[model samples]
Target: MLTRKQHELIRFIQTRLEESGVSPSFEEMKEALDLKSKSGVHRLISALEERGFIRRLPNRARALEVLKQPEDISAGKTAVRAAANSNTALTALKPALAAPREPANDVIELPLHGRIAAGVPIEALEGQATLPVPAALLGPGEHYALEVSGDSMIEAGILDGDFALIRRTNTARDGEIVVALVRGEEATLKYLRHEKGMVWLDPANSAYEPQIYRDSEVEVQGKLAGLLRRYH
Candidate 1:
């Protein structure tokens, strides 16, 4: 059985990795959890590592890998369920709750294009399927989904195996996350930075370096609208 803090830390790490293809930095972990020092982050990471929940890659920065799947952790909730059940009898006298809500009609179906690299530009491929998403999340305009395939944008909460919803457009504002085709060769999902006659694809993870290109050599495919994740 894990302590409350341990469980919270594990969940935080899992969420961070899921949202961004990379593990959270120690400072990030500390700040998120409101820990007093970096030593607290180290101790928690060590505990999780010893329990086979995560692994630290050798000779790499911010290279922690999740060993235990989210499903496995969720399966350990028997105790929590039992505690909830214990309160059922006490609340039984309360009025019954309202009926279950029906599915909303605001769900929009979008094409799921094959994987796109978050770490580096890769050739864009035809979509393999379609997925349903909330229309409010996508806003207006033509949109599509692409599965993220790298940890380069982990710090930005875009993770491997996550679906990034992109609005189809040839233009994007500076500092926005966008799918950029470099030299008409491949498309990469990254934060766009514009300088004098130059465009830079910036990764959110420290382990990877930013890519610089001439403004004329890059084409904007789409701007990121939202993200989706399914834990199994």
Candidate 2:
């Protein structure tokens, strides 16, 4: 069974990987969560792997693959809670309500600054690295990272697993790749073009049709500035 700390750590790692496509290093995890030492963080990670929540590769940095899919993380949480209750060692854990996290709007606050897409939930204070970006990279507003989930932007060379750097804005210029929120909790990556009172979500890929919507139902989350790809 996992302890409360272990469960929180698991969720953190999972969310970080989804946002950045890589797991945090032990030292980073230690600093992020305020652990006593890197070794202590390592122990918790090892325990998580042993319990089937994660799979670790020997000597590989950020090689931890969460065994459960991101969409099914709620189930994982329930399982971890059950496991904790069954273990006598975890009985001492009092529910530590998570501290109120800061909003990601502040520039000084840690930026979840890579691969940001429109409407993706990126909690502030979650990113580890202090981004040392060139002045050219900074836009007027804050940005976030979003892992490209589908191949809808293939014509734009925005493949799956690629990271889109998005500047937060509700307005976009024509021919720009914007993270758009469609009706029904559906977010998509597409080129935004204004036509009369309606907006058209044009995909670069020829196979997909351009989505048309009224301004009220569709929201422009941000405009894509660039992409970052990591090769393993």
Candidate 3:
């Protein structure tokens, strides 16, 4: 089995490839892995390649191609030839860890704009608000952005200063964090619970009570895809 450092390196490489559509440079690897120097990354990379977990092309920049994911080789099967593409390589080397075969989903790059208050209506302000999140995170509904207003969601781990990713909808799955426009005038963040003809916006912390709403009064903005926290 590969050591923890190797595992981390594999994951880092995989993420970089997915993001950039190519392998990272040795310098990038060194920075991402926090190695002392480029040579350190090269040594680990060579070790991985020797183990049949990766492939490298001579004299090519970003030449390292991950041939075996941790799960693939972990099953002890690096002997057989698999398909010739990166996806196949991942599956051949680690079938158990293979990601689902799905089409590319849309991911929005949201900026980390300013904050809003839960207790009062405030003017919306825009600043550096760029955060990339998968389209799947947005519920099957319309798209919208909400300026977080208060600390009500804080006890629930939704901070007051965070930008909440919101999708516009009226229906929400149970236990999903949602942006709900309550009473047509105010918005709040809470977990959704649909039952007994009533929808409940449950808070992550016990300090706040669940916001109950009727089918008509609740405006499901969208499932909270995710949040971006910024400090300046």
Best candidate according to TM-score: 1
After TM-score superposition, the amount by which residue 47's alpha carbon in candidate 1 deviates from its true location, in angstroms, is 28
Task: List model 2 lDDT by residue over 181-205, tens digit each.
Answer: 7763566778888888998888766
In TM-score terms, candidate 1 sits at 0.56
- Runs in model 3 deviating more than 4 A are 2-143
Model 1: weakest 10-residue lDDT segment is: 88-97
Whole-model lDDT for model 1 versus the true structure?
0.69
The local distance difference test score of each candidate is 0.69, 0.57, 0.56
lDDT of 2: 0.57
Q: Alpha carbon lDDT of residue 2, candidate 2? A: 68
Model 1: lDDT of residue 229: 60
Give the alpha carbon lDDT tens digit for every residue of 1-232 in model 3. 8877788787787665433224677787888888899988878887888898888744434545566678843352221222222332211111112332322244555454445444333444346655454443333444555557776655433556555655556666786666666766555667778879997777655566777779788776555643444434
lDDT of 3 at 3: 79
TM-score of each: 0.56, 0.43, 0.45
Off by over 4 Å in 1: 1-104
